[model samples]
Target: MHTNTSTLAASAVDRLRQEIFDGQLPPGTRLAEAAEAKRLGVSRVPVREAFAALERDGLLEFTETGRTVVKQLTPQDFEELFAMRLLLEPAAARSAFPLSRKQQQLLSDNISATRKANSLNEVTRLDLDFHQLIVEASGNTRLLKLWRSLRTELELWLGYLHQQHRDRELDTRVDTAGSHEGILDCFQNRSAAACEKLTREHILSWREWLPMAELET
Candidate 1:
């Protein structure tokens, strides 16, 4: 019974998460446990558990009035999120230098799969997976924990960026694959400094597409 309840809760989580990513449940949309439970054909138990899980994933938040709503990310939120990415990812990549042959192959496979991705959502997942594999390879458990904690927020931000690119008819697949290839080359050559620089630059290159107005320093 416990295992079955857990599975139902996990399923509820995935369904709701995808809905949020697909914009079916846009930001600021309120969610109710009983309603979602009915919609998903599960008991209120799983729905309640899923809500708490989504809250931890940063997709849902409780208002001061105690209503559960989808998270509303602002321009400042994007800016702050990217700032954290810049601080951590490049350093993680540097620490992951001299990646093993198996790790290298995994990255190469990820890029190949990304190139063939049919949807922006798939591209976003592959993109994050590429970076995450590097972080995992770093062998720093604490760093990996921190990175995982940011995973869902990063997905939300990157998904929004990809959608914007799609609306503008900008195909970022080629650019993304090329950038990964360049980073892989650095790893192949065992150039930790170059890898760090390239990784940092790769992240900064995405700043142009930010929805935020540039603030004066």
Candidate 2:
């Protein structure tokens, strides 16, 4: 019974997190456990547990009225989170030299997968996987740990940017794989400076001009 409850809680967390990230449950939206429990056909226990987990991810917070709500993001929040990524990722790429054969294969797979990805979410996921491979290859335990800790927050921002990109009817035909080819080329050449510069540019290419209302909610 205990194991079943835990599984339910984990499922609840995934569903709620995806809803929030996909913009179905906007910021400032109320999170009522009873309502969620009824809607999801689960007990209140799992819903409550899910809330606690999302709260820790900076996605939910309590209002002064003591009600749980999706926490709003700001433009500064996006800038800060992305700026941190710029700083750490390049440094990791610089240090993650002499990639093992397996790591190289992983990166090669990500590159191939990116070209075939159909949706923004799929592209963003593969993009993260590519960057993570580079970071883990660095062999710096502390850097890898910090990067792992940022995964959830990173997913939210990446998903939001990709969604906005599609909403504007931007050129979806642009080759996402083309951007990373240079980085891969640099990696193959063992040029650390080239790899770091290419990686930074690749990340900045995805930067979006977020609307204030969207950021605030």
Candidate 3:
């Protein structure tokens, strides 16, 4: 019974997360537990558990009024998130330096699939796969764990951002995969400096387009 309850809670979490990410539940929108429980066809227990999980994931927060609202990211949140990525990802790329030939091809293929990903979710999955591969290559257990934590937060935030980025015509050509092939080529050729440089530039470039104005809305 305990296991079943946990499974149900996880399912409720995923459904709520998708609703939030797809903008059905926008930032600052209050979530009532009874309403969500009814909507998700689960008991209040699981709904409450899922709310706790989402709060930890940074997608939801409890208010002073004892209500839960979708989290509203502040400018500081955005700045810290990107700044951390800038420091960690480039360092990971530099240390993931000597990836074996097999790892190289795998990362290369991940980038290729990113180019053809049709939906924002698919794009996000491929993007994470590509970068996580680099982090795994670093073979640093600590960095791998940190990267996973970052990925959870990134997944929550980037899913919405990437969808918006793809919707705009001018940004349409600026695929996340654009700098990937170059990065892989540099890594494979053992040009560690160039790989690190390309990775850093790509990370910086993506942040330049994040929808900062959304924080107000």
Best by lDDT: 1
Best by TM-score: 1
Stretches off by above 4 angstroms in model 2 are 167-175, 208-217
Report the C-alpha lDDT of model 2 over 1-217, residue by residue, as the tens digit: 8899999999999999988888788767898989999999999999999999998887888778889998776677777777878888888988877677787888888878887787777777787788888998998899888887777777777676666567632243235566666677788886888778877887676564455326544
Across residues 33-140, which tens digit of lDDT does each residue of candidate 3 receive? Answer: 999889888899999999999998889999887999998856567777788889888888988887899999898788878777767777777777888999899888
Q: Which ten contiguous residues of candidate 3 have the minimum total lDDT? A: 165-174
Q: How does model 1 score by TM-score?
A: 0.92
Score candidate 3 by lDDT: 0.79
Query: Candidate 1 — which pairs collide?
Result: none
- What TM-score would each prediction reach against the true structure? 0.92, 0.87, 0.90
Compared with the true structure, what per-residue lDDT tens digits does model 1 show for residues 1-217? Answer: 9999999999999999998887688778999988999999999998899999999999999889988999887778778877877988899888999899999999999999988988888888888899999999888888888888888988887776665457632367777888999899899985888888998998898787674323311
Candidate 2 overall lDDT versus native = 0.78
In model 3, the clashing pairs are: none
Compute the lDDT of residue 177 as modeled in candidate 1. 82
